[model samples]
Target: MATEKSGTVGKALGLLTLLGDYPEGATAGQIADAVGYPFSTAYRLLNTLVETGFAGYDRREKRYRLGLRIYQLGQKVAHHRGFEGAAVPILQRLTDLTGESSILAVLDDDRFLTVHKVDGPQFRTTTDPGDRGPLHTSALGKVLLACTDPATREHLLETIELTPRTEHSITDRAELRRQIDQVRRRGWAGQQEENDIGMAAVAVPVLSASDRLVAAVALAAPIFRADQEALQAHLPDLRRAAATLALELPLRA
Candidate 1:
């Protein structure tokens, strides 16, 4: 039973992911408090992780950090993502056409993971390739939510805390749901100054051959350079790129 997907094994993996957030390492108590786990359970999981080489403990500081094994597995995952061979060229082409940065993102649990990007001139900020973007404010997040299965999207909307990144973020639940529906109807998503001031974005989904939403590709630029209409005008280009990625990129979902 403990080996079940919802059991301690799963929690331990989640704990391992949480440890990555604390680059400086964390105590068992700190980790427990962060995930609301009991002290005894957290200590046991930490020890098990250490024994399995999934985590490292500094005896002097008594803090735990991600171990070498995680790096090994992460390298393998990066290899499987196949970005260099597949996604990069597509994103680059989209940027070349639109004169804006192109981002490729996937839905990972409750977060939107930025897996690849092609940055245009004067386009570099918080949205790096490895960053985890907020669901309520990002064009990538909105498109993923709109295109995902109804059950998952509903669960995300209910469980995820819509903490506003900026004053323009959609903190109101009803309004956010309405906007998500609009994104669904329009077959693409767009935002202006929702996540960050002076930034605007639009995204289209990369649906699989079976019509499942696999990933999202977005074009982002400064509002001064391209307003909402200008970004939407490039939807033809973005959707073409997304269609190409849908065929090229491997989909686990």
Candidate 2:
């Protein structure tokens, strides 16, 4: 029984790998061809994936895409830290001052997770503490990505396929590398609807006293409230707050 279970796990992993390679998704026949499994076996495995919430079938497209359950699992793993609670008051202050949603994000494996968020009283926003977004499309992700070593950044680029979340998303590796360089030089990052239409964000890196990158803070608002000029105007405040938080973080050494 144990051997049978292991074999089944291997087959499931192969199916998932095949699905991941095709972001638009694939039919059972395509997946079977890629995995070199019999069509009947592939069909059974696909059904199991859909039943277990690891994959979903789109009737319109007749293809299988990754399901929300995977995202929920990733989010669950990313929000395991208790330190996020400590950042709430600071996040609240940023929201109170800027009238935009303040977010605290931590870098996960090639992704960014919002660990804490304070919504502005003026308007309701979609982000929550466990919201997960891609590294290339988010202001918070850019700030954290910039703080990493160049080699690690390259590895991250090589591992994850960048998707165009919006027209402004930096999908090209070269452009993303250039943007990260600018973020490092400027000490902050800004995104104008890079991930969502009519939404904008600005981020600053929080570093430990030993200069290790710890986390990032971001302010998100609608385009009308967070235009390019407004994002630039708030840069100083965001940087100051990040610096203050950095000072409070425990030293790595």
Question: What lDDT does the true structure give each of the candidates?
Answer: 0.85, 0.79
Give lDDT tens digits, candidate 2, residues 46-133: 8899888688787667898675557456556655653345677787888888888888777655788676788888776667766778
For model 1, the superposed segments whose C-alpha errors exceed 4 Å read 1-85
For this target, which candidate reaches the highest TM-score against the unseen true structure?
1
Residue 149's lDDT within candidate 2 is 58
Model 1 lowest lDDT segment of ten: 67-76
> Candidate 2 lDDT (Cα, whole model)?
0.79
Relative to the true structure, candidate 2 reaches a TM of 0.66
TM-score of each: 0.70, 0.66
